[model samples]
Target chain A: MLERVDKAKKQIHNTVDALGRSVNIMEVCGTHTVAIFRSGIRSALPESVKLLSGPGCPVCVTDQGYIDTVMDLAAREDCLIATYGDMIRVPGKNGSLETMNRSNVHVVLSSDDAVQLACAHPDKTVVFVAVGFETTTPATAVAVMTAEKMDLSNFCILSAHKLVVPAMQALLSDTKNKIDAFLCPGHVSVIIGSDAYRPVVEQFSRPCVVAGFEPVQVMEGIAEICRQLADESPQVKSLYSAVVTAQGNTRAWELIEAYFEPYDGPWRGLGCIPNGTLRLKRQYKRFDALVRFGIEEIPKEEPNGCLCGQVLCGLINPPQCGLFDAVCTPDTPVGPCMVSSEGACSAWYKYGRRGKVHHD
Target chain B: MCLAVPARIVELMDDRGVADAMGNRWSVRTTLLPDVQVGDIVLIHAGFAIATVDEEEARKTWELFAEIAEFQERQAPSSKEEGTV
Candidate 1:
């Protein structure tokens, strides 16, 4: 095991030395951002290999419009807002779900809990703010199925689910982007499959390596990318192959396809990506909270002096933002980045480091 | 928010099961992985068993960090049957 770690480190260093240039590797998963920082992998790696955090954090990339919509729903008397703990603190246009001071809002751990909450309270409409990538979408599918099977009347989902592939493509499509390779989100790939990355790898000419959350796994993924760069033959590969198969979880995907359809919607930082947001399918529109509440997702501008948009693009660190620690503390977050526990600003604020953030 | 961990299924009831993730036990839906059984080790993500964890791949993780052997050893207790496991 130690040999494997040493081998990965040596390979990474060799690639950097041979290139004689700084390698910009982006990890497109929020979990990876936290894992890399928590494991101290940033300091362990070569100074030339700058790890850039991409727009992977679901809460952070959740368009301001969606946050505003969720907050609007939270204020309603007829609806009860059920959401993951992270979304409670995220800042919308008016006020956050936590700060709204509403008794109807409930922070649930699992999607199942949202369903259970709906069943328990039959009078109020239980609107679950479903926001996440492919990894967490299946649970929402299951919850929806559960609601349908039980014939629950007061249940619907406000899906802010976005595709990781489209977000990655959007990053590379930009002329100013300088990312060399990608450390793909491991868990999202578990559902979307490794083959899903084939388009980005082939089209963008960047190597994409699927990685696990472990320190060794993350390092191994970086090493694989480094090896690809050294050879000048970039390809899509998976270091975490034990669970992430070529086809991924077909049944899980089937579940997602059964209910949701992809749409090109506005992301917080990156504008409207091609097929970014996943909304409820036509047949399943009855269960869509947006449709039920007559809410429209009008993209809102980020607050003045907030650099969250730039931070998500890997353009600047959190400290570069004027409101970073001074105005935007985690306790009183100005942006979703500082609000989400896995967000880049929260990671930077907590760890006090430079150059890190990512996807699912 | 995509944080998931490998958990050993202690009991399988109809569609849902009670799985133990490093001593933390909770009810998980087996709707995703219908083939999952009571003894199967699965990745518990957002109250659903998303994938069946390959014990070999999981053991490698614990080998690097001994603190997590509790989750690994439960599936493969005896070192003699490591190959079969």
Candidate 2:
């Protein structure tokens, strides 16, 4: 195993040395960002091949209005708010779930926990604050399926899931970040398939490598992209071939299709991308939070002078925003970027961004 | 961030499986793996089994982590080597 690590590290070093010019490699997965930082891989790489973070954090990309709506539901008397731990601290217009911790909102590690909460409290309405990319959507689907299967009307989902491919397209369109290649989100590819990125590769002429969350897998993915870029060949590749397939998991897709449909959703920093978000399908409208709670029009609200939107779209770096370190620390977060642990800004601030060369 | 981990299915309930990941009991939907059994190892993400994992591969990966820990232990100061995991 040590021999394998040595070989891979030597290969990486060789690749970095061979590619004399500066190469910008962007990892478009939040988990990858954490792994990269945790493994201290960035320090191992040469300054020539720079690795940058992208809009891969599900909770970070959730718009302010969506958080406000969830808060609105949390304030209700008959409602019990259920959500992933990451979304709990995200500040809405009034207060965050952390502030409402003593009030009603309950943070659960999994969506099944929310389903159990609904089952246990049949008298109360359990609003599972569903927020994630495709990786986390299946759990919400299972929860919805469970509610339907057991004929439990007490459970509902407030979905804020954003699709990966559309978001990737938006990133490519941006002029600020000239990403040479992309390390695509692994979990999304597990459901959508490695070939799901074929369109982006064909159209934008960028190499997309679908990789697992393992440190080795991530490094290998970067290596794969460098190999493609250095040779001037761009294509969709799978470094995590053990898990990800060309067509992906069919049944997971079926479950997702059965539950939700793509819709225009407002990303916290990326504005609204057409069909970039997932909403509960009409057939399961009874489980839809907006319809069931009759809370449709959430007045749009942006943070005061926060460039979370631009940060999310990769148009600007985190520190470029005046409010980043001074006004928007983790404890007193003003935007979703500062709130989510996987967020690029949160990653930068949490892990030292002192010497990072801010692009654009 | 793409956070995924390998887990062994402890129990199967229709399309759902109760899997254990790093000592955590996760109620995972295993619809992705049609042939997955109670003892089968699977890669899970967002409460769903995204792929069937090869136990041999998992053991190899764990062995790698264990090896790294051992090496790091040996590299630690003489007094701290005894305290290595």
Q: Score the docking of each candidate (DockQ).
A: 0.29, 0.32
Candidate 2 structure lDDT: 0.77
For each candidate, what is the lDDT?
Answer: 0.83, 0.77
lDDT string for model 1 (B1-85, tens) is 8777788899998878898865679888889998888888887777888899977765654453354345336532432111100
Measured on C-alpha atoms, candidate 1 has an lDDT of 0.83
CAPRI verdict on model 1? Answer: acceptable
Native contacts kept, each candidate = 0.59, 0.55
The residue pairs in collision within model 2 are: A30-B1, A31-B1, A31-B2, A269-A309
The true-versus-predicted C-alpha distance at residue A1 of model 2, in Å, is: 5.2
Residue A158 displacement (Å), model 1: 0.4
Model 1 segments more than 4 A misplaced: A353-360, B56-85
Interface RMSD of 1: 10.2
